[model samples]
Target: MKQIVVIGGGPAGVEAAVAAAKGHSQVTLISEGPIGGRTGWDSLLPSKVWLHAAELAGVAEHTAEGVAIGAVHVTPTEVLNRIKQVAQRWSEREAQRLQAAGVKVVHGVAAFHSPHELIVRNDDSQQTLTADAVIIATGSVPRFPPTMKPDGQRIIAPRFASHLNTLPPDMIVIGGGPTGSEFASLFSRLGVKVTWIVGAPGVLPMFDPAAGAALAAAMTAHGATIHQVDVERAERTEGGVVVTTADGATHTAAMAFLAIGRVPDLSRLNLAAAGLEVGANGQLAVDNYGRTVAGHIFVVGDAAGGPMLANRALAQAWIAGRTAAELSAPGYCPHTVVSAVYTVPEIAQVGIVSGGEGELQRVRASYTASLKAYLSDETEGWVELIYDAVNRQIRGGIAVGTHAADMLAPVALAIQTGATIADLAAVFAAYPTLSEVVFAAARAVK
Candidate 1:
């Protein structure tokens, strides 16, 4: 029986460990803290909980929209407690399941002693573990520019932002990525004066231009001041903090949260000692199968670069874990993965948007026509489908509206199975549901 060692304990690590432990392999999962990773504990789950509250608050504020809403209020302490409870429950449940499956769970910091050996340190003791294959699923950490160091009080990071017990008088969210926009939207909906700084010209630069514009407009209507410029520096001031732009203008706020993105957490591992090579951005270079430069050692999730979503990491981990096991088994193929971002109206996509011979013809439809959006009072988003003009097959799809994440599964399936636009349009979706928008969009592509 082969022994597999998985590091990190985040979404990718947990999924990889679970997948690798199946069948005859003896799997050992290691992490510095609890399982569930940063996404489950610090980012996605907590932010979504806050967003749920914000959505209810929006309904209350817009009572004229035909929905009778009572006085909505939130206690930050209660929200934090709920987040902690959910994270703890998930961690405990996953740990129990892995243990029952005969997987060894170790709480510690793991570093490679050699290509096949690891030294794990916990509390005051250290343990040496040897494995036939090692999967590096160690995730990334929130990044802060050298010019601005977070104090966790006035100037903060997302990890700290998730635990705040009180709303600030005024807040400035730096970085216009998905994280920044989500935080800005949540704070603004809670009636906090919010100034959202986007280094680029639009809110979600990675999304389609129209989608980004729609998001910016929605946030603006909800009382968020969007600033699209380079932020030079942030400093603690008399009452709060002052953020200076590259053009020399300064904005003051009671608190500032840095959403500047993240970098792979590989410094402590010392990959060179294990004959591994990192990419230009410091990520462990790996193919779709997660095989690193060392060949025997595999990397998955955020540490492997590309889209850093937790689900994406899990999908990649599934492929990596299976492929690693199949090195001794038979019949394995790598699978294409999908990625999603959870913001107001969510964002989801799958498959590559390629050009040339396999050029994709894009089909777009608005959620304004959906009865569910009308009844739910969430008509500010749309769905887009990309199809191969030659084969008429659905190549990719994106949605930004209520339950976009849930609706994206079908689109991802269609793309994975080479389903054409006509095929998707042929399927009947329940009327008055948000999912109907996808079929409608596919049908519009002619």
Candidate 2:
């Protein structure tokens, strides 16, 4: 059997090890922390739990036509406890999964002993191992500029979100990307005063402008203040944190969340010994198989550096693992992956959100046209589609409302399959469903 080594235990690394083992290869996984890594414990899972709680809080505040619910109260500590329990359960299950797949698990910090070897070390022990092929899936950490540093208290990062014992009365949110937008929306629902400073003109700028405007309107209606400017500096004071803007204005809040961006955490891997280094793009680029310049070394997920999402990482991992084991697998286009922000009246987009370098025609439909949306009191949503006018083929689409990501998924399929507008418009959508809005936009394509 081929001896394969996988470094880091994020979803990508763990999946890669399991896949390689299934291909009749002996795989050893070296992880520094729990099996779930950042996604299972720190960033994705815990954040979802908090967003769910916030959604429930909104449900308890209003009286439905046939349902009467009492006021519900939740503390940050209580949510933190819940997050911890979940992480424990998930980590244990993943460990069992790895064992079932015949993959050995090692706990340590790993570095390259040579291009074809790895040295694993911890405070108490050290070992060297040989590998026929290696997969690197080390994820990233929040990038803090010189003007802002996280103390894990007043000035915080997303990874430390579940650690807060109490919600601040007011917060200053920097960065307008998906991460920043989600946190700003979460605090707005939790009744925290949020002053969002988007370096761009609005939130979710990477998506269609209509989608961004819809989300901004929804958040503003829920008591969040939005600003379009860049932050100059963030400093912690005796009472809280003070943020200065580039426009000569100062803003203060009980907390300042630095949601700017993230940088790959590959420095400890000793890439030089592996005959690899990051390129000019600030990350190591990989091809269809997630392989770098060194044929034996594969890098996936955050280290591959496109969208720092777990689903994208999982896809890359599967391909790398199987290829390493001499198995056959088809590579997928990373652009077709869905991007969703878990805010009230969520935002999701797939394929291209903007029109550029093509003969494209855009069509739009509002949630007001959907009876299901009206019945659910969510008529403030919208959907838009972009198709090639030359061939009437479906290129891309966007959805903003209930289950926005779910609604846009079929469009992603169409783009991948080269389906035409007529193909999607012919698909059956059950009535009183949110997906009808998506179909409506597709049918409207002229």
Candidate 3:
């Protein structure tokens, strides 16, 4: 049997280790943190809990007719504790799953001694391990721009959210991506003054500009101040924090949340020893199979460096793990992945490949067209489907509003299956639902 060593204990690493073991390989997973590591503990799962809280708060804050719902109060300590408990339970379960998979787990710091060799060190002992294949899923850390660094007090990162025993009266959120936009939407809806600064003209640059624009407008309506400019520097004051923009303007808030994006944490890995050099891309580049230039080695997840998305990491882990154990891997198509941003009115999209050489039609429909939108009182959103003129197929789609992700589910599957417009138009939702808005867009294609 092959000996496979996977580094890091995040979702990606654990999945890879289990996958390799299932393929009849002897798998060893080396991690320096608790089960689930950064993803389950501090980053992905924890942030979602906070966002879910924000979602609930948004609903309660809306006063209903003939209702006596009192003012909703959020205690920071309770929220912090709740998030920890949820994350801990999930992490512990993952630990049990890893053990059941029969993959040896090592809690230690790992550094590459050679392409096929690793040196792992714990506080009390150091050991060396040899493997036929090495998968590096060593997650990522928030990347701080030259002049903007979190001080753990007035200025903070999402990872420091556990320390949030008190929500600021006002906060500035930097970075226009999913992390920044979500928090901006969350805090503002929760009645905290929010100043969100985006380097681009709008949020969620990866999605359609219209979706970002709609989200930004909603945030503004929820009492957030949006600054569509780059931030030059941020510093703490006697009472608050001040952020200077690239345009020389200044904005102040009681606290600053730096969602400035993340980069792989490979500083301690000593990649040079393994003959891996992180070049102009600022990361060790890998192929679609998750294999590095050094064929026997692979890097997946945030460490592989593209978008820090869990779906992408999971896919890469499956492919790399199976391949490492000499088993066939179902090839991954980067384009087939769908992404969703969990703001109040969410955004979801899939960028399908354009059918060979023909016009692309963007069929649009408003939430007003859906009976469910009226039922949910969310008749303000929209869905757009991309129709390939040549193939007469529903190639891709985007949604913005309540249950946007749910509405886009069929579209995403359609894109993957290369479903024609007629195929999608005939797809039934069975009821008056948000997905009908997406179907309405497809049926509108003429």
Best-first order by TM-score: 2, 3, 1
The local lDDT score (0 to 100) that residue 327 gets in candidate 1 is 38
For model 1, the stretches where C-alpha displacement exceeds 4 angstroms are: 60-67, 327-338, 353-358
Q: Tell me the RMSD of model 3 versus the true structure.
A: 2.0
Higher-scoring candidate on TM-score, 1 or 3: 3
**What is each predicted model's overall lDDT from 0 to 1?**
0.79, 0.86, 0.85
Q: Report the Cα RMSD per candidate.
A: 2.5, 1.7, 2.0
Regions of candidate 2 where Cα sits further than 4 Å from its true position: none
Instruction: For candidate 3, list the clashing residue pairs, or say none.
Output: none
lDDT of 1 by residue, 1-446 (tens): 98899998777888888778775789999988888877778777788788877776666776655557677888899888888888889888878767877878898999989889999999899999998889989888877778887898999877874678999989999988878878887888788999998885568786666557777887788688988998989999889999999888899999998988888888888687798767788787777688887877888888877566777777778777877666333221222345555566566655654354547688888887678888877787788887877888877777777677777788878866778888998886888898888898977875
- Candidate 2 lDDT score at position 392: 76
Better of 1 and 3 by lDDT: 3
Clash number by candidate, in order: 0, 0, 0
lDDT of 3: 0.85
TM-score of 1: 0.93
Looking at model 2, the pairs that clash are none
Residue range with the least summed lDDT across 10 consecutive positions in model 1: 327-336
lDDT of 3 by residue, 1-446 (tens): 88899999999998898888888789999989898889888877877887878777766766455666877876778888998898889888888878999999998999989878899999989999999999999999888987899999999988887667888889999989998988888788777899999885568887778888888888888788888898999999999899999899999989999998888878899899888999776689788889989899999988988788888899899899988988899776665666788997798787653344458877889999878777667888898888777887777788888878778778777777888888887876757877777777778877
